[model samples]
Target: MRQSYQDWKGQSIEAKRSQLRGETKDLPVPVHIQKEPPFWDVFPENPEVFKLVVQARALGVLRLEENRNTEEKVIRYTRETVIGSENVEIASSWEEAVQVLEVLACRPDKEAIGRQVSAKLADADQAQDKLGLYDQFINYLKQREAELEKIGGSDSPDYKREATIIKDLITSENLQLDNKSKLSVIQLVISPEKPLVDFIEEPHISNISPVEPPFMAGANVFCTECGEQNPARSKFCYNCGTRLVKPN
Candidate 1:
């Protein structure tokens, strides 16, 4: 009366399908058994690693721009770190990019201070070299004493007259004696004149193009008046003016 279990299990696949069709002839198909779409088809693939690439570019200290399908975004960075500020849009040329970076790097932080200090130091050095002040002063005094002797000979009736003449000679000639000559002239005036006889060369008094006074002889000032020369620091003219011309 009842179907044998072995008979049901032994049926061929087609026989089982026929029997299942006969049993479910009046039932609708099951919803759970319906086929599902493949996993790859459901999730689309992304070709680019945009976020990771942006971070990598910043590590290299490069500013970059990414052009998406409909819009563009800029990324700015420096050698030390990425700048979080808004991205700057500029010309796309390589030369323009390089120029902008160079300008930023080369800009001085303290523009005025740096320039002012540099100019002042340059001026001071120029003044020191141009004047040769110390050397000139020593030479001037020595030449003055020699001039005093030439015109007065220590006992001339017009000592002032000789001094005045020496001063005129110094101013007009523009005599620029070296260190050695200045010392020799000083010796000639202070020591016995016989030893320095050769040093004296008839006082080469030539007319300078432009006549000037207070010609420096050696270590003294030759007076334009009275022909009497005096020490370099003399306040008054030895033979005339109570006040001497101040040495510059």
Candidate 2:
């Protein structure tokens, strides 16, 4: 989840210039500039998607915590903005996590965090609605693009993803899938050749169970540079304006 000092070539390290930023050179500064690790670099293939995850987690739009259920380590991203939430667990493996992060990072808006996630099997009770979530996001994407005049733009948003938000009023409980299966579904949704209708797989969302119990988890994220404790979901530390490096 973080890059080591060896991996960070440009970020700053401790210094002894005896220069204080705010106050005159009367005493040593309490904090030095320490850059946080570039976790997005960890997912070069899906940088944008991974970036969204970092941003959303920082904004408290979603919550991430250690997944103690399995022997193979995993981290869970559970929606917290809304009352009844939906969550998805992604593996710790960097490469596999990239594939899963792309799907989770497809959130269309910051509000409805995980609405479009695994739409194929998100809500079995409202299979029709679950299937329609992707379509709704597609429609919204088109409208958003038109608003931004991004029909032929380069910096346009990738609302075409299957996991962006398309807020649902009716709460859909639990939805979790193995890394392989989840990645496959995400790829299929983003595939140009696959028709939207094909995203629907009957009984896909039938396994919906109780939502994950909310945990009072935050401020656990720490900055490796200045040892600043950042908010749990923070991508960077506020004190020294550095990216958070996973502590050793």
- Tens-place lDDT per residue, model 1, 1-248, is 11232132223222433443455332223222334312212222221222122122222223455635325444333221165533233213322332222222222311222343234324433323222422343344344345456665445534443344434433443344444445454554543412321222334533212112354768676556565666786655545444455456
Kindly list the per-residue Cα lDDT of model 2 for residues 171-219, writing each as its tens digit: 2332233333444555555445322212233355643222222234553
Best candidate, lDDT-wise?
2
- Regions of model 2 farther than 4 Å from truth: 5-120, 124-127, 147-248
| Residue pairs in collision within model 2 | 36-242, 36-243, 36-244, 106-164, 107-164, 108-164, 108-165, 219-232
TM-score of predicted structure 1: 0.14
Model 2 poorest 10 in a row by lDDT = 9-18
How much is 119 displaced in model 1, in angstroms? Answer: 33
Candidate lDDT values, in order = 0.35, 0.41
- Candidate 1: segments with Cα more than 4 A from true spot: 1-59, 67-75, 78-85, 89-91, 102-248
